[model samples]
Target: MHVTWGRNIGTTVQSEEDLYFSANSENWFDMSSLGAFDTYTSDNDWVSVEKMVPPVETDDMITTRDVSKLCEDISSLYLNEKFSDVILVLDGEKLHAHKAILARCEYLEALINDGSQHLQQSEIAITDVSPEAFKKLLKFIYTVSTITITSNVGLIVEVLELARQYCFKDLENATIQTLKSALNLKNICSTLNIANLYDLSDLKQACHTFVDQNALEIVTGDGFTDLSQKSVIQLLERDTLLVPEIEIFKSVSKCKLNDDDDNLVIGSVRLSWLTVEDIVSTVWPSKLVEDEKLLGAIVEIVEVKAKTSVCRAKKCMKNNHNWRKIDL
Candidate 1:
């Protein structure tokens, strides 16, 4: 019998009566045990067999059993003054750190390098990030223990800001994922504002989806009007925002922080979807839109609705006539 095998696989030929093969330097298998073939070829004839073996596993397998312990060991070094090469001052407190690990962050690397091969000083000051937030950042850098990141929305937002500010991509991604999972009505607006301000597209899109799903409660809820003009416009532009045009108009009217914002937000609302009375009473009083534009929009909307009503009635009447004409 002849055997064809995949590249890099070992093969050895022996007596055809009971063939044995070893795919590696050690383990060997009998052909009979593998049940690879039912019939044997004659001495004058040749049969072909092909086999491929996957890479072998050994006793010395790579394991992460010590990874967590290693992380914990490194975490103990965090904020410890011993063997510390640098100090970060923030939130009226000093943080101990190693320059080698701090270089993992682009912003911190720049600060440490300071246009030279090494740090100009052992101390760096940061005023924007709070001590609790900076400590969380350091914890993640040392241990990568995401579980310790607080579930509180406010703290998570602070962590997200520090992560972004320091250009810690892993910490930033992890924080955004946490925020995405933590999104709710009470905090969506504030979280969305941060997402928009920093142009964090993934987190921004998550916020948009959450808002779209909880459109009614979110739009009518407190803090809705405090959204940035751009965020308001994004919400108004969605066709799936299942809220009455009147309520949306009310929200948009309240969103007016300035003339430009007012015009943009008002334009985004589908005024034609509102009733004539709604436009006159609610929208007209606000005067967000000009008299001529609002009047024209209302007139056009009323005409379209009237035409639609007449067509529907005519269709019903025709269907009735057909029913009556048919023999029962």
Candidate 2:
């Protein structure tokens, strides 16, 4: 006799069999993965266990097979041009698609319905995006419910740009999330650049946080020299930047920017935070700053340090005054 249980729970073939107490009873085990039932052993009582059975389907439920078949049917129509009404000319290749499916994209809908040149022409030449990225866009249009995004960084970035250009909000969001998860020391700079270019505020903020947290490593890395002057300024101005002021100064000096931007980028560094010796030894020798500006910054650091020392001395004197001769 077969006894039914909840989905992913083991089934029973006999009545009143000793139920083994597996601490992992809630987890489903694939019996097929093991050669036989004798392969599984529990120190506790052995139950008449069988492999977990597929859940019984109800009218309200949708099965995985049904969803798979639906996606497959929809995907089969992708690039099938037999009844296609529009041809998207991307780069040097032509992609055939139906207007109804293309209409799902807000940008394409506006172009197809409103653009004078696009309204009647069956072929539209797209120059801004490559065919590979656009193919992902079409796949999403066809099977959004089941489409898998590529993990390749370059392709994902292309999709991000295409998604934003086409106003594919879901695809854009998914791409941003993927980028966030994919962030690392090597790609953080380029990823930040992409975020800034696309005005992806969420991803931009994540990159900023990552940069600030890994400031020393990021500033010392090779990518530091590739940052734009404006990006470097923005990074240096951040209050949470965890790198030493000397490193910030050194990295900003290495950025490939014009002389005019050098003044701006250098201004973002807290010159007063650098020690007098550091200014004379490192900053002064580097010649990143003019003699006049270097002198002023050095003087300012000296004054601040002197004042700090005075305050500490006074505090120490006051504490000494509070200590009275005590007799044991």
Top candidate by TM-score:
1
Give the per-residue lDDT of model 1 (tens digit) for 14-79. 335434356443445545555545454445444445333445667876558767676678878878
> Residue pairs in steric clash, candidate 2?
none
- Clash number for model 1? 0
Tens-digit per-residue lDDT, 49-163, candidate 2 = 5545334437987778989998788678788877899888888788888888788899888877766688889998887676887888888888784234344678889888899
Local distance difference test scores for all models: 0.72, 0.72
Runs off by more than 4 Å, candidate 1: 1-61, 113-124, 147-152, 306-328
Query: How much lDDT does candidate 1 score?
Result: 0.72
